[model samples]
Target: MSFPIELTAALTGASVNQLRRWSRAGLVTPEIRPSRPMLYSFRDLVALRSVCYLRSEVSLQKVKTAFSNLSEHDLTEHPAAYRFATDGTTVVVWNEDRFMDLVKNPGQFELVTINDVYRSFTNSSDRVVSDFEHPRENLSVAPDRIGGWPTIRGTRVPFDTIADLVADGDVTADEVPDFYPTVSPSAVADAVSFQEEVEGLAG
Candidate 1:
């Protein structure tokens, strides 16, 4: 079922103001009522969760960049599921090969483990947000060690990778291109602008 903006924000741990800003920036546009109230679909919630995962892991700019690569069809029509650690900050989406990997090798993937969430939350002294500063560091270990895409709020990833694609306007949403999926280039540019505007506020 589709969730309203407020529920979507609650589930994603994002502020309504940020959602509005994201819409204005064209990262995750929602259907607008005649009075201009935003109406979000279940797909919108999934997309927002993806954005939240990106933000929690890297930066808001990069999240927007990914959106720019997606056409309206790709952004709104794709059936993506958002998975989060019980802590809430660690969010990942099941998409394409990654989605297949989670299902095929459930015990092997870090993000797909729901068990970890229970363990993490149970041991916490305070609420999860307080501990967002310290996320589960070892997402992947050993020689097979893989890296997660950097998000502004959750993890660190290079900005240039996404910047180059969007700046060149080389990606589209129909099929997964070889370009990085973490963030769309255009979204990155807008995120930069948004960051500047909210430099001092409690964003």
Candidate 2:
């Protein structure tokens, strides 16, 4: 399933504007672009995660260069699938067999290892996963399930979907349980209250 831009932004720590800019630049494009609303697949999210991490370590120009170099190599794997590292001077990618400094001759570098990049990527991915999985009380986000939205615990229903229904006044909190029998009335109320609290903070 594809995810909306808001969830993608939350998962990648990228602003909506940044995502738009990246899309325009051909740096990261969503899988589904059906006119008004854009949707990104999980692969796009993984690619964006790599882009953001690399950009943080080096300049965007260098990151772009690395991507170009990788494309030229005709690597079988996607750029995101490869491990990357930058020493503030050059970018290197692990081509499975060995590390190659894309800035220079795509050869081995003794100073850095794929382990370093792997560790950093793991930490960053963990934080992002944690943030998405537990953004608020009574809500859970499982990237492997439910399209990675803030869903009600123990159910696939998105909290925002239910909250929007109640906020529109078309469905009262008490009636929410009738529509979604899987969720309890208290859970529905919690969803409404959580949305209100979030809106209050945004205001």
Candidate 3:
């Protein structure tokens, strides 16, 4: 499913302006953009998160160079599908066999694996009951369901899935119950609010 730019920015912890700039630079483009309202897929979120993390540690030019080098390799999988680390001087992509350095030169700099970056991203996605109060009473987190993504209580429906629908203009917050009869409008509101709060914290 595709999500609007606001939801994409919220989930990825990247500003709307940053997303636009990256899109212009061919770094992370949305899956749907046939009109004024653009939409992005999960893959785009992963790529944007990677870019945001790299830019935080190094210069934008360095991040661009690293991504350019990465494009030449066989690691074309979605950024979320793989793990990565950086030592402030170089970016490293981890594969099943070994880690591939993205930088041009290989020097004797101490390599610091930023595995926490991926962890932070995952943690942000994993919502739970504690994230909200009475409004989110129906929210839950089950490791066995949907690979641990936050879902409605007693159901496998992810909160983001509903939020995405709302952001896409496919449904209004008041009309969410029609799509998910088991969920209340208040719960839907809570889910969206909780995610926005998470995004604010991430930012």
Candidate 4:
């Protein structure tokens, strides 16, 4: 599913205005929909979030320069097919075939992972957010799932779908199972608590 600009802003650690500016500048644009509000796909989330993370490590000019070089290569792989590693001051792009220091050299791929919403992407070589399977107990995100949004482990129901249900006052933690038999009371609690925790961090 596509996300509205506001939610996209939170996930990317960017303001809506900045995201718009980037889009207009052809830096990172969302997947286009014919008649819908401008919405972002999961791929767009990864790219934009990467820009934010890299910007924190290096200067905006450096990030842009790296992206300028990145645009010159063929990007036929899935948006999250590539991997990266960074120290506080340097960034490198890695793939099975080669490695390129983004600041000193450049490459074609871009992918992201998150912990503390950013470290997993920078410090770990084994994890890719697109390939990620778990966020919390009873929650999973797999490419085969709905846009890879975290979902109730065995079902297609998104974790946020349940969290929003209770947070909106339409249900209680104990009442969730009546609506989704696969979701136990504890899963409901997990969903709500997870949502609260993420929103707090994103805020």
Cα lDDT of model 2 by residue, 161-195, tens digit: 88887887888767887888877655665576557
From the highest lDDT down, the ranking of the candidates is 2, 4, 3, 1
Give the lDDT of residue 99 in candidate 2: 62
- Model 3 residue pairs with clashes: none
Off by over 4 Å in 2: 107-203
Q: List the residue pairs that clash in candidate 4.
A: none
Better of 2 and 3 by TM-score: 2
lDDT of 1 at 140: 13
**Could you tell me how far off, in angstroms, the CA of residue 99 lies in candidate 3 after the best superposition?**
1.9
Candidates 2 and 3, the one with greater lDDT:
2
RMSD of every prediction:
16.0, 11.7, 10.4, 10.8
Local distance difference test values of all predictions, in order? 0.42, 0.68, 0.64, 0.66
Q: How far is candidate 2 from the true structure (C-alpha RMSD, Å)?
A: 11.7
Query: Residue-pair clashes per candidate, as listed?
Result: 17, 0, 0, 0
TM-score of each: 0.37, 0.54, 0.54, 0.54
**Candidate 3: which stretches are off by over 4 Å?**
104-203
Candidate 2, residue 54: CA error in Å? Answer: 1.1
lDDT of 4 at 47: 75
